[model samples]
Target: MNPLIQGLATIILGVGGCIGYFYASNLLLDKVLYPAKGPNIASNIRRANIIRPWLFIFPALLVLTVYLAYPVVGSAYRSLFNRSGDEFIALGNYVALLESPEFRRSFLNNALWAIFVPVMSVTAGLIAAQLSDTLKWGNIAKSLIFMPMAISFVGASLIWKFVYAVDSDIGLINAVLAGLFGAGPIDVIQIPFWNNFFLMFILVWIQTGFAMVILSAALRGIPEETIEAAILDGANPFQIFFRIKMPQIFSTIVVVWTTITVASLKIFDIVYAMTGGNFGTEILPSYMMSFMFRDDGRATSVALVIMIIVLPVMISNIRQAQKELR
Candidate 1:
């Protein structure tokens, strides 16, 4: 059979099966569980009662267990075994990961990213949001500032790659530096700790727009009467921002911070595209991918490491969501 035809057949069958199952289930429920009375029914015949809403939730719970919960448990099991999936290696992979200098470096780089990217991105976004809020052409300023978010991470990295290209005439950064300092073109990605900073700048650039959009909406949500009251009480602009507006949107600030933190934790595309995790710029995700082909155990260990690193922020975000629900 043709591969395309087989693929189409599979999709059609899957859709038909789902539709048929839903239709049959509804028919069965209506006929057997919730049947209507007819004119010939006995007067003393008891009607069936509907089950509680929680009983109706069982199918969704089962689906989640099969799709989400099972996979997580299976991955955790796989992380314990070696590449062959036969021999149990216990914590050997994790131990090697911790003891290896390269892994350590990746951990430190990821740690730096987690710390700096969120803080800098949210800070820049907050400042931009505040400034744009007070400006007459706020929408125009916001549209320009938020334009970078429209670019994918890979595209942004490619764009910045040009900015950091080695040629003094072509790369904007080197061009500006060469004109000023009369120095030769330098490779930005090869510059040790500074390269991490360069890679982080891309994330900050992309995420600042995200932070701005969220924080700006939060800023606009602040009541006008509160700001006027603060002004009447002799509060200056700084005081109004810090004392009045900041308090009102503190939860939103936390949400933006955690959101950016989670994104920075899983950041792989920018670093991968820009440097391929070279020159001491390897974060956890990129470093993990390097081990994938050579050693599956080590790669899975690194995957678990990323999961551990991200778990806290995920929990915090969940808690924030719960609080918001209340």
Candidate 2:
């Protein structure tokens, strides 16, 4: 029962079982149910071809139903109930949730975060992409900037927590401010309303790198002819960017925007690690986590709210993907 052995066993069994099932099922269908050697071979082959795709997809569909669909449906169902889930109090949790000042604050903060994070991240990313494209050491510069994307949210939060620490000697920001401007040690994350922005800065910092990497690739993918054509028209750098490059990469920008938007909606780790959802920095995900064990119904309600917010972005992404696929 060693952990590593257990893991290896699980992996072997899972993969081996999947391979065995598919092989056995296909063999049974082709050889046993409708043999290709017998009469009506052409029709049997056509039938098998039609059914084979479903057979291949069946396992994946089942996995999605269990892992993705069930949780969402179950959470929606749970959101209508009371604390212990014995009493069916339809919409009561939502009503109480909406009426509460804390939840409202969290909702407002989330809205602000959703707005700021995506826009700023995308803007910063675009700027980085453009600037890096002109430099000889651009890849090195980009590697440094995009490095934060590899850092975990919790790790980034911890790093920023030290930077924003209240102790002037310990916190770099406080130390710099106090040394230069003689400013007092500022508890940045303790201030209400504005504290939300402070917390959001961490996410923006982390997400900017992700945004940069994606936007950079999109920028690189832009044709050289378009820029040359713009140059021929006496277009300035700003004009070239806004008029030509921006239009070309608009869909990519939307993809980055919606991606960060979804991440912001589901943001939890940074806020949880840094502020613990304190000082009015409670976002939907963190707020939901706060009530997770204490109030199942209410927690599920918050989760549903987060899901509702993300639904549009998810749909938009899906449509964009499908359009691209077509």
Q: Which residue pairs does candidate 2 place in steric collision? A: none
- The TM-scores, one per candidate, come to 0.87, 0.95
Segments in model 1 whose C-alpha atoms lie over 4 Å from true places: 1-21, 38-67, 323-326
Clashes of 1: 0
RMSD (Cα, Å) of model 2: 1.6
Model 2 segments beyond 4 Å from truth? 321-326
Best by lDDT: 2
In candidate 1, list every pair of residues with a backbone clash.
none
Positional deviation of residue 165's Cα in model 2 after best superposition, in angstroms: 1.2
Model 2 collision count? 0
Per-residue lDDT of 254-307 in model 2, one digit per residue for the tens?
Answer: 888988988888879998998887877888898999998899999999999988
Give per-residue lDDT, candidate 1, residue 11: 96
Task: Report residue 34 deviation for candidate 2 (angstroms).
Answer: 2.0
Q: Residue-wise lDDT of candidate 1 within 1-326, one digit each (tens)?
A: 99999999989998897777666665665566555556623331333223423345656788999987786677677778887878998998888888999899999999999899999998999999999988999989888889999999999999999999999878999998899998888998898799999999999999998899899999999999999998999999999988999999998998889888888888799889998988889889999889888877778788888888888877877887799899
